[model samples]
Every structure is written in C-alpha cells, then in structure tokens.
Target: MILVIGGTGTTGRIVAAKLAERGHPTRIASRHPSTEGVRFDWYDPTTHPDALRDVRAIYAIPPVGEVDPAPIMLPFLERARSAGVRRVVLLSSSAIGPAGHGLGMVHARLGELFVQWAVLRPSWFMENFVGEQPHAVSAREQGEIVSATGTARVGFVDPADIAEVAVRALTDPTPHNTDHLITGPEALSYDEIAAVLSEVSGRPVKHRAIDPVGLAARHTANGIPPDFARFLASLDTAIAAGAEDRTTSTVADVTGRTPRTFRDFCRDRLRGDRPG
Candidate 1:
C-alpha cells in the first residue's frame, strides 16, 4: 500500500490518482476523512499510525513556505520507517541550496533510513498560474503581475511532471535515494510570463517590478505576516541575482519524457476566458 500525505493538494492528488490507476492500494492523508480513502493529518501526530498502517511506500509533501518542517516531517517519517515502509519520495523545492542545509535535513534523515528514496527538487510550479498566485490574478483582473524579481528568469516546472516522476519513483527502485532537479522546458522571466498571459488570456497583462521593501509592504497588506513578507522579498532578491535560472534534463532522465513548456501550460489553463 502507498500512503500520500497532503493528498488533497495539487501534486499529492495527482500522485494518488496515478498510483491508484496503476493498481496500487493508495491511502490519502488529510485532516478530513473521505470516501476516497483513509484521511490523516500531519499536524496531529495522533493521526499518523492510522495513515501509516500497512503502508509500504510513502510520498511526503511538507507544508509550503515553511521555514521549519522538521518537527512535523521527522516524526511522521520515523513512524513510517518503523512501520516497515521501504520506499519514499519527498517533494522538495529547487530553491533549497547546494549543500541542502535547511530542508535537506529531512532528506538527510530519510537517507539514513536505508529506504529507496528520491528527493524531487522542482523549480517554481506552473500551477501558480491557476492556483494561489495573486500576481496572476492581479494580472488577469487588473492588467498587471507584480513581483520583486527584476529581470530574473525561472525554470518554472509543471506539477504534472512532478507527479509523474514521483509515481515512477515510488514504483521503480532504479533511482534509489537520489536527488532529481526537475524543471520546465525553458526559463522565463516574470515579464515573459506576463506577456504570455496577455497573449493567451487575451488581456493586456503587464509585469510590474517593485522594490523589495515595496513588495514586502504589499505582501503584508495582503495579510501575509510581516516576517514572512520580508523573507519572500529576500528570496526575490536572490532570484533577481540569478539564483534560479539553471535548467536540467533530469526530468526526462527520470521520467523518459521532456517537461512541458510554459506556453503549453498557459494554453491549457489560461487560454479560456474565465473571469477571475
């Protein structure tokens, strides 16, 4: 049996569906129980056993924008290991540094567990177009996508590819305990993204580059905590300094297919004329 934490989420949902399609008995972990499968919550340790019971493989998706995910992830991972789970896949960010110091802590521990593991270090998700990215919404609604990343290019990856690779990692043992840097077909600046939006969505979407302090103020005004807003601004500065422009063939190397292009993503998700 395979257990997927954050199963209701974008990547987790796709992973669970793919696993089930391949005849794997899949369990979904969420706070709310559902008819699809067993529901479990990561925040509450009491729910771990019921979710991990009889599971042989696991997919771990830690909460996003989290500076400290260890407290929740480590305990759940240890529990899964004790339950005899042998294979695991972790959804990590590409923003994690070279030494993998911060979030790498979790991957390091998973490495010590002797399980067949694959850490997916994916770039910015294309899902931002359709999901919680307020910049995209602001563009569609108000004719502008604002960011602090001035002239920075990002290899924005599609979540579907991430899901496909994750499923293969869980089912196949070849790429055991390795890190895969997943990215899209090309790197694109936010300005280019805005242009794409303008073309696809049939609206004049513009990219507005704000200073870091100004961006922080906007984020705080949008209800993000001040500390997190400042942190986000700092990340933008790093990106502006060319931190995330690198591209890789690892996605195709692992999944035997090229990653989707941002144009394709925009065509599929944003081409429709839906009012946001």
Candidate 2:
C-alpha cells in the first residue's frame, strides 16, 4: 500500500489519482478525515501511527509555513522507517538544494534514512496561472500581473508531469536515489507568460514589475504572514538575479516524454477559461 501525504493538495491529488489508476492500494493522509483514508498532521504525533499502517511506500510533502520542516518531518519519517516503509518520494522545490533552507533539510535527511528514495525539485507550476496563484488570476481579471522578477524567466513545469514522475519514483523497482530537477521545455518571463495568456484567452494582460520589498508588503497586507511573504518575494528577487532561468531534460528522461511547453499549458488549461 502507498500513503500519500497532503493527498488533497495540488500535486498530491493528481499523484493519488494516478496511483489509483495503476491499481495501487493508495491511502490519503490529511489533517481532515474527509476521504476514506487516515487523518495525519505533521504537528500532531498521534496521527502518525495509524497513517503508517500497512503502507510500504510514501509520497511525502513537508509541512508548510516553517523555515525548517525537519522538526515536524524527521520524527514521522523515523516512524515510517521503523514500520517497514521502504520507498519515499518527496515533493520539493527547484530552488532548494542540499544546503538550502526548509525542504533542503528534509532532502538531506531522506538520503540518510531511506536507500530507495527520489526527490523531485520541480520548477514553478504552469497551473499557477489558472489556479491558486493570486498574481496570475489577478492578471486575467484586472489585465495586469504584478511581480518582483523583472525580466527573469522560469521554465514552468506541468503538474501532470510532476505527478507522473512521482508515480514512477514510488513504484519503480530501481531506487532513483537522486534529485530530479524537473522543468518545462522552454523558459519564459512573466511578460511572455502574460502575452501567451492574452493570446490564448483573447484578453489584454500585462506584467507589472514591483520592488521586492513592496511586493512582500503587499502580500502581508493581503493576509499572508510577514516572514513567508518576504520569503516568497525573495524567490522573485532571486529570479530577477537570474536564478530560475533554465530548462532540464530530466522530465523526458524519467517519463519517456518531453516536458510540456508553456504554450501547451496555456492552450490546454487557459484557452477557454477566461476571467469573467
């Protein structure tokens, strides 16, 4: 059996569905016990035992809002290891490395605990345009997207591609004990992305670059925590410094197919979903 943590989340939901389609006995773990699965919370220790039951593989997502997830995750992973779970696939970020903060600590620890593990460091999701990312949706509605990234570009990857890679990492016999830097076929700036959305949806959209500090303040004003808001803005700051402007072949190499282009994502997901 496979246990999917954060199972109802963006990538987790897709991962669970794909695993189910492939005949895997999948159990979803979440804070709420809404589905036919287990209730699991990283901050709550009592929830771990039942969730770990009869599970051989785990799809793990670290608790959000913490600069270091190791305090919440390492203990649970220890329990999982003791309970005979062999394989683990972690959903991490492309910006984090072995020495970075937050997920990086978890990534380093995963290597020490499990011999069979894969870390997926996927770039920004293409779904951000049509889903929960406020800037993208706001662009569609108000005709302008705001960012601190300036002209820097990102090779935004598809969630489906990330899910497929997670599935393969979990079920494959070979232990891909390495980090996979997943990305789209091409890099695109926020301006280019806005142009694509405008063309696909037949609407006028523009990219507005703001100061990183101002962006952080804006996010804080919108109810995001001060530290997290600053951290998020820092990602854009790094992008403006040319941090995320790269593509990778890991998606094609692992999934046996090329990563979807931003144009493809816009065509399929944003073509008919224009803002009212």
What does the lDDT read for residue 67 in candidate 2? 63
lDDT of 2 by residue, 171-210 (tens): 9889899999999999999999999888887889999999
Say which candidate scores most in lDDT: 2
- Record all residue pairs in model 1 with backbone atoms less than 3 Å apart, i.e. clashing: 30-40
Model 2 clash pairs?
Answer: none
Backbone clash total for model 1 is: 1
User: Any runs in candidate 1 off by more than 4 Å, and if so which?
Assistant: 98-101, 274-276
lDDT of 1 by residue, 1-276 (tens): 999988888899999999989999999887665787676766777888888889999898986666667776887788788889988899987876324445678877778874588898899888887645777668767898888899999999999999998999898857467888889989999999888888888888888999999999998998888887897898788889998898899889888999999889888887556556
Instruction: Kindly provide the TM-score of model 1 when superposed on the true structure, using C-alpha atoms.
Output: 0.93
lDDT of 2 at 219: 86
lDDT of each candidate versus the true structure:
0.84, 0.89
lDDT of 2: 0.89
